[model samples]
Target: MTTPTIPGFTRHRVRVDDGVALNAAVGGAGSPVVLLHGFPQTHLMWRHVAADLAADHTVICPDLRGYGASDKPAESGAGVYAKRTMARDVVRLAAALGHDRFTLAGHDRGALVAFRAAMDHPDAVSRALFLDVLPTLDMWGALRGVSAAVGFHLYLMAQAPGLPEKMIEAAPEPFFAHFLDAWTRDADAIPADVRAHYLAASAAAVPSIVADYRASAGVDVEHDTVDREAGNKLAMPVTVLQQDWGAALGYHARGLWSAWSDALRHRTVSCGHFMAEEDPRLIAAEIRALADR
Candidate 1:
């Protein structure tokens, strides 16, 4: 599938672990920063911010296991796509690239992975930026009324094994295109060509993509709950940029995150769920601030 082009970046595949390989676009030169894309999209989601960050940082934008050109192995079980494993894949990918410790950022489902990475590998992540997502537990707890309606996809994807995969595979384009269109504030931000790439990549990886989301409800929650009970929080500085959905959803987004992070900077951005695409400069600035920490 065609991927977005970042002017100074060159694409490469990194074998993160057995049965998992990440298709990454590597660029620039300096302390490494890995940017993970969320569902229905790939590393291409970071095109604008990656190029800007590439000016000083060794920016690594990788399609999380099941997306883009990355390998989409069969899910052995629910834990297969758990954020814990995905986090390990990311840590390995960074270490293989010679970065033992670095800054990290994720948008959407990617943000979930990045959060797990920070909690599981504190020393390895100097700082983390989470875009448009809450902790998985908090996310589930906050669902009600309109919020639940908007997050219907999460429930749809978190279904029993064959069902979600079978349904999405039947008509992947419209299924994938639904999110690309629904979540973006400016349709122009994601050009028609870019949207096509997202649809194509997602269509080809429906089963694995569904498995990834399914894990969030099962193993991902188990992991998060264990961490929460153990009083485990991200040691690194954490930056959260999200739409002001907390009040509407009957939540204090910052309060929830503050419980998981001592050094937290939370702010609201008036964009749709795809903040990175809607405002790359703003997202880049947040990363730069976190990197400076």
Candidate 2:
């Protein structure tokens, strides 16, 4: 596959762990900040935010294991795509890049992964930003009747039999592009090359990506269950930016997040689901506030 470039950032590949290689772009220089992208997107989602953050911080944005130019492996079981394993990959990636501890932020699926990272490696994450997602347990617990029906993809991909993978592979572009187009408020914000790169990556890693969603619905929820039972709230300061999905969707976003952390600051952004890509300045300001905390 041809390498797609984001202006003002240099891309590099780092071996995060066995069977996992992350495509990362590094820029600027200061306290390290790792940006993890969500579903159907690579690190390119961080283009605008990274450029500005790099001016004041060392911005490390990596395509998560199954996304972008990163290693895509066949689905074996729940272990490979579990947030624990994915979070470990990030820890190793940071250590490889000479960051023993750093601030981190994640959007959508990436936010879930970052939450797990903070839980698993508390000492390593200085601050965390969760964009547009609830804790795994809260999310699943909130799902009911129509709510569960609306999030059909979660249950669909998490099916025991390999149906979602087969279905997704059948129409990769349109299926993947739907999320890309729907999430972003501006279509042109993500350039053609970057959009194509995302499509290519999603097509190649359909199975692994499915495995990730499956794990979220299964083992990842188990992890969150255990954490909640133990009363494990995030020790580090956290900032959450999300759409008013609670009012729109019948779930209280801020109330749910406040239950998970003592030092939590939550805001409802007017942007679409893809806040980082749709509104970088707001995201940057939130990150800066989290950094200061």
Candidate 3:
């Protein structure tokens, strides 16, 4: 059977960085919007919302550097998987696709990349939506004590090389499946085929995936922290959608976002972490609202 993809979208292997090519699905017309996927899944995670937006705008969904059909380069250094590098791949991807500027929407890890892109190259990103994530600098500060248990994987993958990659590769399926099973609020949202696709793809990407998380614990935090101290901020209109982890995590989600955005609309939702899949219509509508602004 052929792989499942967003209906009507055409796929392309676009090289956005040196020796790195991102597998992307591009469709629709009019102004452009790029959708970036979260962990343990491919761009297919944006299928529902992407299809909805394609009816009115050009939609481009690309698997991040180390995920899905994209090229997974060996982690020669901390910069390899840093979101800044990944974000540059995206800016170049849009330019290579003939768009000088586009609205962006990213979830989880993807959102973190989008967050950096908006900050570093504000002129190229017209507007953005970041879903279910805290900026890296803020995330480390937020996790503490027993409440931090929910993010055990973060600490696990953050360890120095060799060990983290070996531990995950030993039983990749179950290791990846744990998040797939735990994060979704509705099982029907992923379905069986999509879940299988995510597991298979993630299983094959253990090393690169571990490098991504490891960068989060090291270089990624450095980039965000340096920018934070410089007082760099997003120049575009910004929208943040998150499952209210504030009360349980002892931090205010809106307050954290406000520090980085002057034009921010932060919405706390009941939908699971994978809000794009669990509530596609709301996700699509929110993207439309933000893109329009």
Q: Is candidate 1 or candidate 2 better by lDDT?
A: 1
Once fitted onto the true fold, the runs of candidate 1 whose alpha carbons sit more than 4 angstroms away are: none
TM-score of 2: 0.95
Clash number for candidate 2: 1
**Candidate 3: minimum summed lDDT over ten consecutive residues — where?**
1-10
Give a tens-digit lDDT track for model 2, residues 1-293. 56565567788888877767888999888889999999888888888899888888889998898887789766687788899989998999899999989999998889999999998898899999999898888888777777566577788888875689889999999999988887777787777887888898889889888988988988898998898889888889998988876754688888899888899989888888877877899898889778766
CA lDDT, every model vs. true structure: 0.89, 0.86, 0.93
Model 1: pairs clashing at backbone N, Cα or C within 3 Å:
none
Which candidate number would show the highest TM-score if scored against the true structure? 3
Q: Candidates ranked by lDDT, best first?
A: 3, 1, 2
What is the per-residue lDDT of model 3 for residues 1-293, given as tens digits with 9 covering 90 to 100?
35788989999999987899999999999789999999988999999999999999999999999999999999999999999999999999999999989999999999999998988888899999999999999999999999999999999999998998888888998998899889988989998889899999999899998999999999999998898999988999999999989989999889999999999999988989889999999999999988877
Score residue 36 of candidate 1 by CA lDDT.
Answer: 96
Model 3 TM-score on a 0 to 1 scale: 0.99
